[model samples]
Target: MAQHPTDANVYFVPARSKAPIFASVSMFVMMMGVASWLNDVSWGKVAFFTGMAMMIATLFYWFGEVIRESQGGHYNRQVDVSFRMGMVWFIFSEVMFFGAFFGALFYTRQYALPWLGGEGDGVMTNALLWDGYSAAWPSAGPGQVGGHFQTIPAWGLPLVNTLILLTSGVTLTIAHHALKAGQRRALLFWLGLTVVLGITFLFLQAEEYIHAYSELNLTLGSGIYGSTFFMLTGFHGAHVALGTIMLLVMWFRALKGHFTKDHHFGFEAAAWYWHFVDVVWLGLFLFVYVL
Candidate 1:
């Protein structure tokens, strides 16, 4: 067995290939799809579906590789540190992603909406736009594009999702503990259950989105309010989907006897991602739904 410098009992691993390439390819497909969608091209649906399919396929193959490497005893303490750092940076990037949306929400609500509402004696090119617009946090008007969605309330489905996420986080933590303790069966059970919880959350969120579009009158074209709402919550939902996939991958790897108490960077990395998504959703619930 290949051994670690710091711990001879633990194997040091360097086995990897194709994941980066696959991820890159998947990203390119997604970007192309998005661009096509934005430009109102006929191939938008094709691009979008192709991109998503590639991305999903890549994740499965890529994670299978990681699982194989882990079971083969390739990772070590040093590798664990690298994985941890990578996850941290990835979460940081996600934070910046949400930050941009939050900033837009802030600007629209605090400054732009007010000025357009003709509040506080503002002057300049705001006169014509203000004719029918009112100063509002949930801005819905002619000036506001796609401004019709009734804001999804924080007290209902959003809160339920929040609790589900929080509970899932707790379950994931328990699963981690089981892994660290070498309780393989327990770990797998909890991890699999966590994934179930995540899937349920996603399903509920989809239903909520449907309700918003059909009943609440909230839509992507309702204006800045709808746009921001969808952008923030939709992005968060995307993260949840990604996180759920990560957890499910982890569950399958555990079932395959991939991770041991002494070495499990792959599991750790997935856990980190799941936790990051949970935190991001919390922020979204508070800022986008409540505030």
Candidate 2:
């Protein structure tokens, strides 16, 4: 049944949902599968894929239900405010998540590496552990953990990807403006272009990873540099993939005449997420690549 906007004072409370439980179960399965796979369990790969499938299916259904409810006018001003707050906090949590990883990188470079190389209070410690081990920006620890490896050049694919993401941000902004002005054709065109740019960025990143692993001998096992580099960039790539999907969904919704000028929190939320991704990528380009 549809809800009426006239009764806006009455808050709409949805029926209890099983989605949260299912989502938790799916995540548990996925983590267990990953752990098992890391430990060389035979069925771990299958279990991991199974969990991933379950999670995807669950999110599809859950999001569909929310979309239906929104389209049915079950959400009002209060709900809109709540959704905005939720997204804001969600992004804040993401910031903290990345902050931890960046902190690790900073600590390793600024303190740990220097200490291990006989700096400060580590002179005796270095003499005791591994003598003549000079501290370097791209060191592979004491024993050359995964052998010497070359880093990906910052001026190559990374710079191109940066430009691509920045361009996509501009396109998305144009699309948002067009949506507000009720220019359907321009909105779809720019949004579609933004999605294409996102896919291109992902493709380029995959190529960069391939080049690094095959030619440069850079990989997850290469060293702390390899581990942190991949961890940060890989996670950002995953976020970009997620943001691309969100924008694709919004494009479809816009095609179906879903959002009006005044009521388009769905589009706004996706836009906010996409912009956050862009900002994160800028940080990555500076710290992970350039600096």
Each prediction's whole-model lDDT (CA): 0.80, 0.92
Clashes of each: 11, 0
RMSD of each: 3.2, 1.5
Best by TM-score: 2
Candidate 2's displacement at residue 270, Å, is: 0.8
Worst 10 residues of 1 by lDDT: 1-10
What would the per-residue lDDT of candidate 2 be over residues 122-180, giving only the tens digit for each residue?
A: 99979999898989988778888899999988899999999999999999999999999
- What digit string (tens of lDDT, one per residue) describes model 1 on residues 14-95? 4456778888887898888889989998888788888889887888787666666656556666666777888789888878
Model 1 TM-score (2 dp): 0.87
Candidate 1, 182: how far from true, in Å? 2.1
Give the distance in Å from residue 254's predicted Cα in candidate 2 to where it truly belongs.
0.9
Candidate 2 lDDT trough over 10 residues, lowest sum: 1-10
Cα-based TM-score, every candidate: 0.87, 0.97
